[model samples]
Target: MDRRRLLTTAVLGGAAGLVGATALGSLSPEDVWAAEGANAKINPGDPDPNFVEGRVTAVSDAVVFVTSSDGTYHSIRVTTGTSIWKLNPSTLDEVKVGDGLYARGVRMPDNTLAADSLWVNIVNLNAHVDSIGRGHLNLDHHGQRVVAHVEQGRSAAVYNNTPAVSDMSMLQAGKHVKVIGAWHPDTNEITISTVYAAV
Candidate 1:
């Protein structure tokens, strides 16, 4: 077998006996996302060619089948080393048909992706802050109002390229911000994991 397939087989063997947190490891979703992108030669903001965005159409053993939003079909191979995020670090069992996915991984010679990281129902949105309420922010995203809830202890804010902090006190009304969070499918609501705004 080729090196990639060989490595995948080994991981599948090792992962079959593990589940939950022990199988997924402690890496944050963004850590895996950014780390994989950083190692590639793509420019910042340029879509990583190794990335795939789609909806899960099927799942079998360690493989997930997806149909991209644009209609391309993909086979994603998940191994123990893959970091999965479904709201938080997750297991493959949490993935379901119809769930949206964003995956980054190495492409095998057969055109399958050997997934390094998989994020289910994740959204990165740009919006204008309309108002702030008790533990939440009302946002206007492309003219649609959205309710973003602050997940205390997990929610954080990043300002002007500085380190992220849990304090969201600097957010102001009518300012533009980028939101990275888990989307509540079919609804204009999300739970904020990180908010990027000016200090």
Candidate 2:
């Protein structure tokens, strides 16, 4: 057990930067939508009438009915170019009733939302960095290990609450972090979208 402990410690030590740094933010709106299997128009930081938050109530061939948190109802149309994300990249067929959602698109004359992108059950987590590995990192969330895989050129890091950047080197092991990622199909693994930390 002594040798095993020593080896494990060494491995973790090398993996853990044990330095002082941080990271923050998420994928661009267009990139996020594209990951859902479409390249539809999803303008980033635009002040247009193109957003909705609600719970799915019904789904038809290419249309979805939803009830907003305020009790208002909306008809959202999903086109071929419309992107849908549920946990991981997903298809329209996977969208089900009762799933919370956020959609961005244009409004048709009939008042139905022509969705360009839809993200279902997205999660934002606060955790502490446990260890770092090549192209991945281990995070601790309430005592559970959340293995976050780094997507090449996609993971954004923000240190000390500064502007977001694509440099993962800013992330130091053993620091508290905010992770924006998608939960893997049915596992503790997560595909990291962005990470925010304080140095």
Candidate 3:
């Protein structure tokens, strides 16, 4: 198996057995969402928090393991409940293995980082198009290729309302564009929020 597939399987297996009933305990769904939102925004500059800054060491189908500059390693498991979105879709492909990452989550006893949200920092990208398809666009920025999925709508009204691929004609292969969206590592897809041609 390829390295990506192997990593994904290992993490998912660990999460299934270790997470257990902990996610079902005292926190209500609303409480959990609120906590997750709060956790998602925590950063190192904060006065007091449980947030950690690290670099992605490995990305598996179900987990992303990160190591901090201080030499601490964290095993972050992604689940159906995990929220993965990009601040910029056109630039999402800019993230790489050695790139820096900031994550926030409730800590586990084993010192693994059980992140509620994973944010890909895009400050390093020079911005360019990698490839484009009939219903998809691949962006090459920094050292990664971010793929954005687009689908046609039934009518103009429907097309206007659909965020996935509203303006298909505006996107062209090899054209410089910007995108913003979310990433789903489980399926290896990115749901784009917006697509823009580079000025």
Candidate 4:
């Protein structure tokens, strides 16, 4: 794997053989942004060909089967190099049927995605900051109120394309922002991973 994939897989991908989570040195928001950026580069105008977003329907020892929201079937192969993230670093054993999954990897000749990174129950939203509390932010996402909980010491903010920081005091109400988080299935809530906004 390259340095970018290593860092991302190490940070978001669980700590195990191939590239352990400790290899990244820290679970900083930078890694999260970088990983997402990498995936975004796949297709500028078209859909990402190397990404899969769907619900897991079946899991075997080394492969996961998914059915996307559009009913497209995907077969993903998991290897030692694959990194699993479920709110945090996790193992393949943690993957279960019905879990939401977002995977990025190489598309194989056989049509199976050779997954390098897996984010289970992850969510990305564009919303306006409705309110900011001691440990959470209320957002108006597509006219729906969403409660986003901030994880102390884990959540970070990137203001105006600047470096990521833990200081969220700069966030203002009514500002439009992008949020990357882990979703609590079937709820209007999420645990924030990173918040991107303009100062």
Question: What lDDT does each candidate get?
Answer: 0.80, 0.69, 0.49, 0.79
Q: Write candidate 4's Cα lDDT for 14-91 as tens digits.
A: 443465543433333346556565536654667787889999999987889999998999998776666677767778
Mark the regions of model 3 whose C-alpha exceeds 4 Å error after superposition: 1-49, 88-96, 122-199
| Higher-TM-score candidate of 1 and 2 | 1
Question: In candidate 1, what are the lDDT values of residues 80-196, reduced to their tens digit?
Answer: 667788877789999998888988767776888877678888877899999999999999999999999999888899999789999999999999999888887778888998899
Question: Which of candidates 2 and 3 reaches a greater lDDT?
Answer: 2
Index of the highest-TM-score prediction? 1
Q: Which candidate order results from sorting by TM-score in descending order?
A: 1, 4, 2, 3
lDDT leader: 1
TM-scores for every predicted model? 0.76, 0.51, 0.36, 0.72
The C-alpha stretches of model 4 lying farther than 4 A from their native spots are: 1-49, 108-110
**Candidate 1 TM-score over all chains jointly:** 0.76
Tell me the tens digit of each residue's lDDT in model 3 across 1-199.
2323332333445434333222323222222333544534546555323456677778875567778778887777654333433343112234457655665555555655555545553222223567767667777766667766663441111132343435556455666655544455434355554554532
- Candidate 1 or 4, higher TM-score? 1
Tens digit of lDDT per residue, candidate 2, span 1-199?
2322322332234422232111111224425544542533647655345567778899997789989887988888765445676655578888888777888766766777776568776657789999999999999999999998888876677788788788898788889998877666347887777788888
Candidate 3, residue 9: how far the Cα is off, in Å: 19
Q: Which pairs clash in model 3?
A: 7-60, 8-60, 8-61, 85-182, 86-181, 86-182, 88-180, 89-179, 89-180, 90-179
When superposed on Cα atoms, how far off is each prediction in RMSD? 4.4, 18.8, 11.3, 5.6
Residue 71 lDDT (model 1): 96
Which TM-score value belongs to model 4? Answer: 0.72
